[model samples]
Target: MKFPTVRHCWTAFLLLLASGLSAKEVPPPPDPPRLVNDFVGLLSRTESQALENKLVAYDDSTSTQIAIVIERSLEGDDIFDYSFRLAEAWGIGRKGKDNGILIYIAFEDRQIWIQTGSGAEGFLPDVMAKRIIDNIIVPAFRQQAYFQGLDRATDAIMQLGSGEFEPEGLGKKKISAARVIFFIVLLIVLFILLSRMGGGGGGGYYRGGRYDRGGGWIWWG
Candidate 1:
């Protein structure tokens, strides 16, 4: 019986290895930055009429998510009020080495307004809010795309928000441990397979080449 030629055998083995690897799934990328405007703070900064007007413009007559609440004063160490639980807040609020981005919003003169957190206050000055309305939000609104405008505006804001480094201490260590475990498992599996393929009563490759138990011959140098 003629088994596959040497070159064909090597080619087939490589193909099999490639096919096996292709079955593995790739992990997804991280989520994009989110927009988390503190509603209470926003209202305190702007007039209610103007805030409502802006909402109508942004929401295109559907601004339900934006809530208007009567905020009571909270001390320096007080519970956060009217703060939405945005997914991005995990990476935002009190960012480790990475300073957090806290967008403060409140009613000012009965209008909806926002103030970037102290850390980010310098970058996204309240003064820029006017430009944001003119350049970003207004354009999105004019196109009759409120949600899309929010995304565009927030994305642009986040672009400005980035650049601060955030180091996850214990969290980073945990991730490292996970990678170590994965590598150990992979090594263990590879060694187990190699051992089964050799050091057993079977035909397998060795230091120099395969050992043919039946033939008991060094097939070729």
Candidate 2:
């Protein structure tokens, strides 16, 4: 009987090796959170409403708190500069890079106006982000659910905004989440150690290899 050639044997071996290799798992995209404090520059703009000290509501019809950014153009060499007027027309108006903008929001003519910056990275998409603010942030504010709306807005911001040098959002100032976790673990270890001080006479865990109630040198039962 005729046998397979060397090339055929090589091909068979390669096929077997490929089959043995498990498919590479495509990891889910990073969802790091974005906070306002991360930005190098920060500004807030608020407008006064001629109302008494009563509760004020913010909805699609009334937006109480809003933020806006005015960006400048980056030269051909300095790639950090981001365009003001983008193709999507998501209120990316023109204004030289001299100034950054901040706008306190108020709904008008059934439409929301947003200004994004070349600096902000990983933020909600302009149009969608605007919609989220209108539908979620505003209503939550009206209901006094400030944290809820703020959390949602923050999460969205991290996903769509842009960065200056690093396309990722800015690193937070306070302790990182990992650091906080490590601290908690350390605290637990300390607590356990303190509890197991074993203050003499059947104090520590396991007195007589089983259990002895009398607080003495546990007599073998």
Candidate 3:
């Protein structure tokens, strides 16, 4: 068998190297700024400072931690997965609360993901998270106003976390008196159902004393 030419061998080696590189996983970018990490250097010094101050204030007041990260790209990793991992790695929230929130933006991919920890889910659920991205962040991003987008989005998130932010129109709907009354009625009905299920008529006497306490039969020693 004839040996391949040197050029052909070099080309094959290059192809193999490329294949290996493609299969390798790309690690997440470093967190130099800690609070607001712009790995791709997208934000200006002033913009970064402003965002850092906003987040610091938010944390100080509510103890709810929020982090913003902007990367040129995540290579091949899914943003949702990357966000969660980054939050976990950074320990963004308090130890016991797990209330961290991560705002991940991939510029090249044109994708964003809001990752909320267990503690934050109460304040920022899936719907609210998506709304902030779709309405607030995406709009600014489309206009090529990254700083504005990040600033507004962060403010909105902080407000929502503190229960102070409410969007107009759909988000501003107040609970009517009728709805409040209906909710109370529903709770009363649920309580009755649960009581019936739990109270088994006190059929068995534990200690030979049948005690009728407040219209409910109780058997105790």
Candidate 4:
């Protein structure tokens, strides 16, 4: 009787890996009852209603959909993957526009993710999303101000979606321009130094090769 071949063993290992991955796939929660689904009871009834109303009005006016989901835990699944699957399953945005945003919070895992539809990515980019998480949400959550965090973060998202506010990076273009100017100036200075060093009398001369003058070696081309 011949033992299992290496190829057979490798194929068996791949199958086991696939089975493990399938086991870890967690099903998304049920369809959202409203724009805000706080399954963990993180928000009070009044707070949820107020947020829901605000989101409803925004959606009604702009037709851009934003949904918030707060789960007790992600059930040992990756938050990004779970959020992407959830957003896909829920069909959160308009069909053609694909302008949807899903703010997912895994309370027990202490992980939060913002999944934006293709159309919405232009307005709410990864940098802006990171800013919202770091500057607004995380700070408020750290102080146990979950409602405040969500409220402010959603407000920012709405402002971006509605074109009421520009992302912080917009202003950074000026800084980048200034840096370009600085880099140009630096290059000019380097060119001047190189010219002066290579221009003087017999001290330095270009011979289409490397030259050493007891000070240092310089390549001349």
TM-score of each: 0.28, 0.24, 0.65, 0.69
Which candidate, 1 or 3, has the higher TM-score? 3
Regions of model 3 farther than 4 Å from truth: 1-33, 169-221
Model 1 alpha-carbon miss at residue 74, Å? 19
Full ranking by TM-score: 4, 3, 1, 2
Give one clash count per candidate, in the order shown.
24, 15, 0, 0
Worst 10 contiguous positions by lDDT, candidate 4: 211-220
Better candidate number, 1 or 4, judged by lDDT: 4
Query: Against the hidden true structure, what lDDT does model 1 obtain?
Result: 0.36
- In angstroms, give how far residue 121 of model 4 lies from its true place: 0.8
In candidate 3, clashing pairs total: 0
Question: What is candidate 1's lDDT per residue for 68-163, written digit by digit as tens?
Answer: 232222222111211212212334333322223332222222212232333444445444533454455555545654445444544444444453
Question: How large is the C-alpha RMSD of every model relative to the true structure?
Answer: 26.1, 24.7, 20.2, 16.4
Tell me how far the alpha carbon of residue 177 in candidate 4 is from the true structure, in angstroms, after superposition: 4.6
TM-score of predicted structure 3: 0.65
Candidate 3 all-Cα RMSD? 20.2
- Model 4 earns a TM-score of 0.69
lDDT of 4 by residue, 69-155 (tens): 888877766555566667767777777777878888888778787877777777887667766777778778888898999998899
Write down the lDDT that model 4 would get.
0.71
Better of 1 and 2 by lDDT: 1
Off by over 4 Å in 2: 1-103, 106-113, 119-124, 162-221
Clashing pairs for model 4 are none
